[model samples]
Target: MAVRVLAAGLAGLVAAAGLAACTPAPSGPPVAVLFPGAADDDWGASAEVLRRELADDGYAVEVRFAGDDIPRQLEQLREVLAAQPAAVVIAPVDATAIAAVLTPDAAGEVSVIAYDELILDTDQVDYFATFDHRAAGRLQAQALVDGLGLADDPDAGPFAVELLAGSGDDRGAQDAFAGAMEVLQPYLDAGRLTVPSGRTDLEQAAILRGSPATAADRVAELLAADVPLAGVLSPSDAMSGAVAEVLAAAGVEVVAPGARWSAAPLPPEGEPSATPTPPGATAPPPDATTPPHTDAAPDSAADAAHDRAAPASVVLTGGGSTLDGVRAVRNGAQTATVYEDPRELARAVASMVREVVEGAAPTVTQGATTDNGVRAVPTLLREPQLVATVEEARRVLG
Candidate 1:
């Protein structure tokens, strides 16, 4: 399976090489910006890539790190907004808190490009660049299903699951959970997954640290449970890494078949979809219908969120912890790691920012609308890559 996916990825890269050559020359110095949080964060990888991509476009970039403090970030944004930059790219710590600094009146003059995360009130920002986060969740869930071969038998028993989501304060985390549930719903509803109560917030760092003893108590229950955990769905690569440590201590193997991957296109669309047939198994068509979309009004999504049915014999892992997760996959400590090409996502943002600064419609793909109370946000849904070990990493990272 790795060999086939790697071949497809290599072909896609080779094909994209030509288009890479035809990219337009830089229009001006790369836009200056401020990013939320510490530079070492797993979430900041894409932001760093955007910083580099802007420099490559010949823009003079100035980045102020606003250490996840919403108030401080707002102050920084106010200061940067006043400077009248060609554009101010930001990954807001509190998407809504940043609203006070960004008003429709103040937003028109300079390009405000939200990178990785969608800033609330899209009507206020000129453009947004991010991976298709919902798709990312679906990818993670599918990987769990695939690794455990859940689709093969409907009668298979539920796999014990542990779920550790990111801060519910972050909408992206919610979206990631939603996407994964989209895939897991069928299996879960069918009793293929048994989710213990305290699992949802199990691996959150802040929550755990805030109440160490309580958190440890819950984790201990999970650790002592006799049932084998089919897998866990952590919200990012970081959480997945933490879960891997816990599961390793518990002595269970982890496998990820549809780990995270960038939504970059293959060398050509319609490239043959290659998948292997497990012994005694009839292979599913490469283009078999992806999980159903259970379409619902965007406005009511929060209140009536789409949950999943159950699946058989699966351990689901979520989170795009990237490099660390990839390392785990390589060492066989993990089944797979979600591979999000920070470089590509960054370039997409750079291009969109450039367009906004230059007063042109952005080139980013506009997909389904996401509601964040302020307004309906048009999102760019980039595909994610799933990396299964060091070998797959070499193929995509190169």
Candidate 2:
């Protein structure tokens, strides 16, 4: 069962005992897992996996969600630190703000493992475990190139592409943008790809907190201005769904490579899929409407004729293998999404915590370190896979 505590009651919950109820009075010392929020499917899945694995390893596990409130998270962290658990694994809401609460004295004798997001400006973190964000960004860019047939036809005239980067505060987001630009800058220079909106800088393209509505609004503005967009490099699956809907509403076709648009009407947004989502895969967005397929019949003969005269299809790329993303790929709404298994990430963090609790060195790849502005923290990075087809999505997500 998913456990979420209201931000207002967090202090009471911690004072009463800890954030979560332990697993049947386990024998070993207690461990605590802190996540940014319960809303994100990736964090929810990871929290459950961590709870089970840590309990199996003879540790009494307690999990808590901060509900995306930085002040509330700080309060929870302070309270958790007061109890002095054997270890604490955290995926921060605000990476820099959390550093203020995780001083050496505050985290005394407790092993701190940064989960997913790195804790910056503090040397207090013991280890960092996350996916290779730069590589994920590179894969998204490559997907756009492949979907647009740019590799085979380099002379394709001035294809207009818009870049949507992740949140500005996130270090991972910055790295991803940089990596994507490394691959895309050459095309821009050669005039193969053009930014009609001219919002190419990370500052301009960034969607605060990776908000889907913000991304959708920006794309809508671009569309209203009649910017000829051949492709859109979306940052995540949720944002991709939002952007796709805006395009679909404007009668633009969004299709993956080699995928034909389905004529079947799309199920309502956030409707439970007949296909069950596999464990560890991100959940579909609750409020985002699925984009309409290109082959759907128009309401009138005039509308049908207009559809037949529609402009070129747009190639859109996303990451985070959410269920909606898979379905969108199947129905020709999104081009591709990169898959990063959250269960694998949880297992890695659990292993590191166990190592620390058992008084052994945490196993990390040799010389894999992430500089957290203070010192080089030992880091473990997992690779992500790109899925364009439903078969590939099922295989990778499952």
Index of the highest-TM-score prediction:
2
* Model 2 residue pairs with clashes: none
Off by over 4 Å in 1: 1-30, 38-48, 121-123, 196-219, 255-316
CA RMSD of each candidate after superposition: 17.6, 13.3
Indicate the TM-score of model 1. 0.69
lDDT of 2 by residue, 337-361 (tens): 8777788888988999989999999
How does residue 166 of candidate 2 score in lDDT?
Answer: 93
In lDDT terms, how accurate is model 2? 0.79
